[model samples]
Target: MIKHSIRVTPNRKGIWFIVNRGRIWLSAKRELPQGTYNELILSAEPEQFCLIGQLGDQDAYLLVNHDHIANEDEWVTPRELLTVSEETFQLAARAVQVALFLQTHRFCGQCGSAMSLVSWELAALCNKCGHRCYPRIAPCVLVGIVKDNQILLARSNRHRAGFFSILAGFVESGETLEQAAVREVKEEVGIDIANLRYVGSQPWPFPHSLMTGFIADYVAGDIVCQPHEIEEAYWFSFDQLPETPLEQTLSGQIIAQLKQISGNKKAT
Candidate 1:
């Protein structure tokens, strides 16, 4: 089973954190310092503070601001936290998402009134309009297209040179996850796919995205790369695949699964 170090809970305070823009303040040991939530809340004001969750035995609090804290020993981005540990990355991602949500939804959209935090849950309530706003999670699809021992991979213009991975795209409104996968493959590489089996999902919080994974069979059409999105497209043999993303991502997970299946067939 997967282990999570941080647990979601109602507002309480034991450990203090300050977030400026997207960077988080960390101590010399690359850890969030401990401080009283009550004191921090009083000084920082309730609007600037958010109760993220419980980290082990302490309650984790986040202070969101546009200005940096001079008292902080070090400042690091969420990507930097990934280098420390998976648990740290998870916590940092969650914190950043919550912080961004709070920052963006400071006022009610329906009514021009300041919103208030709804205790016992992760949401904001507008006293005037009674409108509740929750954190946003954009759903996306990542697919690995396999044909015999070859898997279809594409290099996107956004990715670094010498890196390629599975086809992916954001799910449009009123579209099913399966439909999104099929559409993404068709649009990016100009091919049809079948047997789109669901593999797994991963929370990719570059800006709060939940990526669902799939493995599909190549159906028809030659690879005609999408003009702006795909830089190159190719079907790679299992033994001659290009450098891809790490296993921590859904695309990597899909590729790893295909490699294992290909290896098993070769062995048998």
Candidate 2:
């Protein structure tokens, strides 16, 4: 479905680039412009570059340590990229992930040997010790617990004031996604949950994380916020909920879903 190639063609308009230090260099309009790699006037050729993938009819490339090319172009961070079109955002996210992978995989961890990119795949190969490494995608679980017309939300100590979100944690080794969901919920809020139904998944590219979402019904236990983790935890009625995450995130999506389900139930 998705086409990817290593070939670079000259005379094309300009290439979309994920440039230095995990930022995207694009037109000043904050959009993907029509262009080719040949049109870019760089101070020097990029030391590291990879053809990430074809976005629509254009090829996007990820370049490391790129020199500033034009005054009309602006560099945007990954978070700012999310405000653009969904297609552009997804492309930029993928480019960032690839760039980060290349940056950290230059040397083999096991043999201390220099590693080279494998031509046919997205991986690093250590010729000396025959070690190969691929981009890491950490799996995380996000769970929304619903009880009647009220939903459980928590404020993490790390978040800014007034921001609340559902329970979430990274999946540890040798644990199932369901197990992680339950454990995270209990450990973070001191509550028990059951009927963890798979809701959805999102590719969160803050250095490559795959968030798997789940919705669970509250079974038992009173709220006991974990120190240094959850600053506050409470069950808020649907109409009286506090400030939550943006709808673009999995946590916000799950919360919206819960609201819709509750509304329908009340209507019927």
Candidate 3:
């Protein structure tokens, strides 16, 4: 089990995830610092110490250091760890999200009182009005609408030309994953989808986002891009697709799966 907001000593030894601002401190090799707390030799005193989880036999901890550890090789965002081992990436994600949660949730939202960490849990309690807050995780849906050998790819307004990916949007307050998929597809590309197949999930910690992926069959509607939302969207053949998301991303995985399924059908 993972421990949060725990006390630790400078002599404590383990893997360290020293985070500052939104980036994490790393060695020159772009790897997390490991060893005893003092051996890590942090430039600034950490605002907090959290035992995120266990990495193998060693305990993994996050040092919330808000100071800007100067130099480019000193820090990198969690995105840099995408190509690393899944276990390492997960630990890095947890570290950053927990740090961000602690940094932002210092003050109570409802009562405007200083919040203190609960001794035995990952939450902050506002003693003034009994308000409690946990780390916020925004749930997002990734819909890969497939129609035979083609997959629908879209370039959002935020993306530049040539790059495209599957449709994605945040889940609404009272909607299922399937509902969110259908709604996001329709609103983003004016398409209808069905036969939603659950794929997998990935923790994307750009300030804490959980991406749930799905593969749905295209049902109807034309590709009419939403103004100021989607730049361009079209059904691209698996054989001849333009630039898309990397294989490390969910959209990329979905596209690759569609292509693989198509290849299998042809072989059969």
Candidate 4:
């Protein structure tokens, strides 16, 4: 007698991030569409795509949808995903950045030849010129200055009254994250800081930025807001603070840490 047996496997779902003209598609429930084409909410097939990462044992793909104005309400910017869980926010960050990279690096800068995606890595290569390009990430620093139980905050010229955050600036060509933090604080508020402590880092996808946070001790100098940059600067007591970034952001995290260290109530 002969016996045969068949084994069956469950089909896991993949998270699809459909992007059109920089905006990502969300389900009516306002969530990333999961599964393959069967679960994809959009109708257009992608002309470009990238496997970003895995989420919950399922793969996550970045699909570049065609440029159109259909279902406008379903397409939301990455900023809208800030309230989502950290995992979702992270995938969305990579999706948008990768999409931007694919869109911008379609041609070789050296030979003006068409670029194609590399099979083994997240990069675009030009066969003619042998040139390759990868996603760009700008490094930025967020410095939360502390004096006694007070924290130094500033409102940039671009910010409205009331909303303020820790001092932030981009890392220059030859500058380190620590150097950038100190220089940003000094340039924006005309102050000196000592005893800098590394706090944490966050992926800020406002056009691709990695924010490295630091807690610095206020050493000297008065608040002299830089023109054309800082609208105002002040040191506020931990208990009484103005509007600030959300708790999901690095700035907010550092602020919460500082308040906890001071044994003060959490900021609203």
Q: Which model scores highest in lDDT?
A: 3
The lDDT values for all models are 0.79, 0.80, 0.87, 0.81
Q: Report RMSD for candidate 3.
A: 1.4
Task: State the weakest 10-residue window (summed lDDT) of model 3.
Answer: 1-10
Give candidate 4's TM-score: 0.89
lDDT of 2 at 80: 68
* Reference-based TM-score, model 1: 0.83
In model 4, the number of clashes is 0
Name the runs in model 1 displaced over 4 angstroms: 1-17, 32-47, 69-74
Return the clash pairs for model 3, or none.
none
List the candidates ranked by TM-score, beginning with the highest.
Answer: 3, 2, 4, 1
Cα displacement (Å) at residue 30, model 4: 1.5
Minimum summed lDDT over a 10-residue window in model 2 is located at: 1-10
Which residue pairs collide in model 1, if any? none
Best by TM-score: 3
**Per-model TM-score versus the true fold:** 0.83, 0.90, 0.95, 0.89
Pairs clashing in candidate 2?
Answer: 13-35, 13-36, 14-35, 14-36, 15-36
lDDT digits (tens) for residues 51-72 of candidate 3: 8898889999988987747785
